[model samples]
Target: MVLNELGARINTALQALSREAVIDERAVDALLREICGALLESDVNVRLVHTLRQNVKKRVDLDELAASSNKRKVVQSAVFDELCRLVDPGVQPWKPQRGKQNVVMFVGLQGSGKTTSCTKLAAYYKRKGLKVGLVCADTFRAGAFDQLKQNASRAHIPYYGSYTEPDPVRIAVDGVAQFRASKFDLIIVDTSGRHKQEAELFAEMEQIAAAIKPHNTIFVMDGTIGQAADAQARAFKQSADIGSIIITKMDGHAKGGGAISAVAATGSPIEFIGTGEHIHDLDAFSARSFVSKMLGLGDIGGLVETVKDMQLEKNEDMMKNLAKGVFTLKDMRDQLQSILKMGPLSKIMGMVPGMSPEMMQGFDADESTRRLRSYMCVFDSMTEAELNSDGKPFENESRLRRVARGSGVRPVEIQALLHQHRQFGQLVKKMGGPKGMLGKMNPAMMQQMAKNPAAAANPANMLKQMGGMGGMQKMIQQMGGMSGVQNMMKQMMGGGGGGGGMQEMMAQMMGGGGGGMQNMMAQMMGGRR
Candidate 1:
């Protein structure tokens, strides 16, 4: 299992305690056992796992707890904090100063994904408004310059490399001098990777480091290598003074925990994680945020940064309407478009409280994108009044049929889309419409609020300011009480809810008319029913 699966297992163990009348020593021991098993299975160092278990046991003494303290809360907090610390090397990551030429050299073993990471890092800085350049110095690998050229072309980053340059040291020195003279703020040099840690590779790296004198030397480690990454990373660090680490291929089925913990154990801070092969897949590493999301506790800082990057002010008109509880079909279409700009739905969902990667896997981003486009097509077939109207414009069967015919879709889909729009309106109203939880939040406060468990997990507190405890109780009852809420959350968290009640609530929660997100995904995919 990967780290995600490990986290889910640990989360289940911790959540099981919520059912207990009182958390006892037995319950605590059971929780630790489950966690230990999960970490060990994910290839975490056995000694580290043992230390984690011992630390949790020492901190979670049921007998020593005060009567007023919540045993479950304290125990869970301790586990979460410890998990964060396990992957953190306690070293500051290297930062490139703005307007300064920063040459970052990449070193790793063969197939560790060092070259691609070089382009990804360059793209990352380029997107941040930096003048970035890439240098292909991997003379050892056949077609290495060609690969770097292609990647750099896609990222639109300037590059320097020579097919005839047999010496990597000369290429590294020349590329750095050229880009530095051109005033590129972030210049990245891609070094050759060997099949193993060889003397030749180290000598080459030493020569390149001396020539370029890079501001930061990053070692890219393959996440699938597990605990073996420690020895590899330490060897590279010994060779060229590695300033940071980047773990690649995290999108694969690798047990990434061992790779991460191993690298951290080598005293190198993880600077970024390559989640996918896409140029935009690089994510800045944060131990706290990563572990928080792993435990189904959302990464608010990441979400906030994505939204800010989108410049939400550009959607001011739509925001104003949403605040007033006016969610027309057009507004829904607009929101979906904005979500596309924010990146993959699975990634966005992973940043939501209680939403896990396991749950988010249900959403196919391409299909979701297609479905959103199809919804826009249906909207396009409608009259302007119908599109702008806050009322149900598709209530008439004739109008629905006409839309279906025009958009090349089934009538049922149009109906589902309209129903989803109304649910969104209802959800907005239930939360006090305009001036409610979402509308009232500034980006910074929104992140801080998500970190508070009471704010993120409790619907009652979220709605308390809107309608008080009485209204909150009434709403909870409408959703079939606390048990119903838990069931819905389980399905939402990818816990496999097959019950009719759970499905119905999930459908409603998704605001997908009568269908749930899965149904919407299927419709978008347009595959076998």
Candidate 2:
């Protein structure tokens, strides 16, 4: 959790409202006060916290609510929307253009994780099939070029920097020209970061900007800096045209909200957030998705996008089995392998709804990965008949004992694995079996859903179908619901995807649709534009 304390306080405040028989103005005011206090404690600027409180109060009008309306939903939506507004500055982030050389420059104060973020961004683009290169133009700091060069080498990205070049401007110009001549699609220049804002450093940044003329200048801000992020971001914006922002070291900060919302207020959309130290820890910032996850609504859209990018399109049998709502041990194995291919479980889990990065911190990714490997070993020990036995093998003590011996793993581990597999199969069967939940989807929506896994499991669509709170509770009861959902989450976590039931539902929802979830939801709600 980026701001675990704040998230917990907000959840507590909202849950209190849900417990109330009737939410009135007093309740709303109390909730806002608690939220305001949480924000202030998280180091959010006083003015910004005050604005958020006022905005939330303005949106949640007690007198305007009809007797028949669900006040909780209205209040929850208002809180969510206000949170989104708090971090969105109404600006579009810069996007790289294809078939053209895109130059991006990194600028920030020292100790802001500027140099590391530059390499991370380069690696991100490199992984996306872009011909990316890095240029180290930081002559002021000691070992600046060496650090960038080392990171670039580790990532296998082409880089240009000179230890002997005393002038940063010349190095930047030469690096850019060389990479351009080589036809690199994206060239990133890393500039010097000072201990603090200084006139000399600002002048140097301006000179570097003039020399290379970057397409985007990204100001990398340290997320742990609290309210000071605003001033630092504003200072850089003055020195250079900062087209985008990247907040780093977010995993270690409780005051991340202050840094994020403050930087957004500087009229720059946060393009990416550095969640961890790994090269792949960067996530593209989305206000709605971020806010949704913060409130436990989950980032279903992001989860689906992760699956899509995994290029599992060729897993036809898995998709077919999923469509039929038949999840076998082999299918679980396949899903686990797909998750392993995606990335670390911690990062994947953060994208899912109901599962926050904070709660996920309790489950170690390395431990999970090892557990998956152990489960696979157990799977390898089983005969083909045992693997496809559809829960029969687990009922027989002999097969379980044999698997335990052959896999060289403990019997309890094998038993636990079997138990999880059966639960997953039952849950999948409930979701996609004959007369399954996804089977009842509109033809148009299903057609569009088939293409995207995330869109298929869109929370918005689920919220619509369940008819809000009452309908949702009833539906949950019928589906063996929360327990089933928990099992699904455990299965996903075990598989290394961290999606839980939402991922399973989304996977089922794909009904094999190809268009975006928004279009599908529009058709379902008759709210299509």
Candidate 3:
């Protein structure tokens, strides 16, 4: 199983605890056992897993939790924080500054994905509106420059490499100098992947590092290597000032333990994660964001930054409307259009709080996309007044049929769209009032929070004001856990409809208000059904 399965298993264990009427030491130990077993199966080092187990046990005092209003929620929050601690080295990764040359060097074992990650990193920076360049300094590997050239060309990034130059050091110096002179914001140097056993290649790595003096020397490790990544990462760190790490091939069936081990090995924070083969697959690394996404909690700030990276035009009116708790069919339609503008449905869903990769896999991306477009068609067929109005305008059966005929979709789908609109509107109304989540948040601060999670972590953050982990949890509590997430997605994805979603299961979470965030994800992912 990959990390997705690992996350699923851990979630499954926690869900078991949610069922017990009483929370105690035995139950907590059982949860820890299941969680530790999942992590161990994923190739996490036994020692680390033991440490995590002990740490969580030490933190979640059952006696204290019993007195707490929501036992499961407090325990879940503890686990989330501990998981974040496991991967985060507590060191700040370096960021490139605009209008200044920032050189980065990549080194790792052969076939560790150093070459591809270099281009992906460059593309990530390029999308941020930075002037980025790539340098191929792998003289040991045949066609290394050719690979970098092909990848760079595909990403439309400026690159430097020589077919005739036999000295990798000279090429490294010249490439950095060229890009430095050209005023590139970020220049990435891709070195030949080498193990510590390769003395000459290790020397070459040192020479290139000395020449470029890269601000960040990244060690790329393959996530599938599991616990073995520790030694490889340590070897590279000894040879170079390996400032940060990038673990590649994480989207595949990686054991996932290797990623955590690599962090422990180098004591360097992960700067980025390569999720797929595409140049756009790279994601900025944050410990909180990673753990949240892994546990099926969405990263709103991360998603906001991603859309911002696209440099799309801002719809300020939409923000004002949302702040006022106003949501109409047009708002929902606008959201669908935005989803279309985003990349793959699965990738986008992974960032959503409730949808984990495992739950997302259950969905057909093409079909979900088609469903979104179909919703747009339904809206397009509606009269401007109808689109702008509340669902009172859709009560006429004849209007529903007319839209159904116009969009060539069943009337049921149109009804489903209206149902979704109603639910979203109700949820928004609850969240946007003067006492709601966005009430105290200025539109700009909300946007900034979405782009920078650190600000969101502030005590004065919007989620805090909303009495939530993000917002959905408290809102789910406030609304008494209306169970429609599954139905909403089932209609949108075309099948797999089931019972009351998470409503019946989590309806009791808000006893005067203590709904855990996992509550919303359970609702969002339909009990992970």
How close is every model to the real structure, measured as TM-score?
0.76, 0.79, 0.73
Candidate 3 C-alpha lDDT tens digits along 316-348:
444445556777677566655655655565566
User: How many steric overlaps are in each model, in order?
Assistant: 2, 12, 3
Candidate 3 local accuracy as lDDT?
A: 0.71
Q: Judged by lDDT relative to the true structure, which candidate is superior, 1 or 3?
A: 3
Candidate 3 displacement at residue 207 in angstroms: 0.4
Please report, in order, the local distance difference test score of every candidate based on alpha carbons. Answer: 0.69, 0.72, 0.71
**CA deviation > 4 Å runs, candidate 1:** 16-27, 61-64, 252-254, 323-325, 328-330, 356-363, 376-412, 426-529
Q: Pick the candidate with the highest lDDT.
A: 2
Report the alpha-carbon TM-score of model 1 versus the true structure. 0.76
After superposition, the stretches of candidate 3 with alpha carbons farther than 4 Å from their true spots are 63-71, 252-254, 311-341, 356-358, 366-482, 495-529
Candidate 2 lDDT over 1-529, as tens digits, reads 4566677789889889889887998888888888888888877778877888888788878788788889888998888788777778889899899899999999887888898898888987876779999999999989988899899899899999998989999999999999999999999999999534488888989999998999999988888888777777777777789898888888746788768755555788888888887777787789887766666556656666666665555555554465467777776666666666556666766655566544565566777767767777888988887766676767888878888899888887776666666666775676564476555556664554456454544546645543455554554566555665445555555443321332333333332222222223222222110
Report the lDDT of model 2 for residue 469.
50
Clashing pairs in 1: 323-434, 420-513
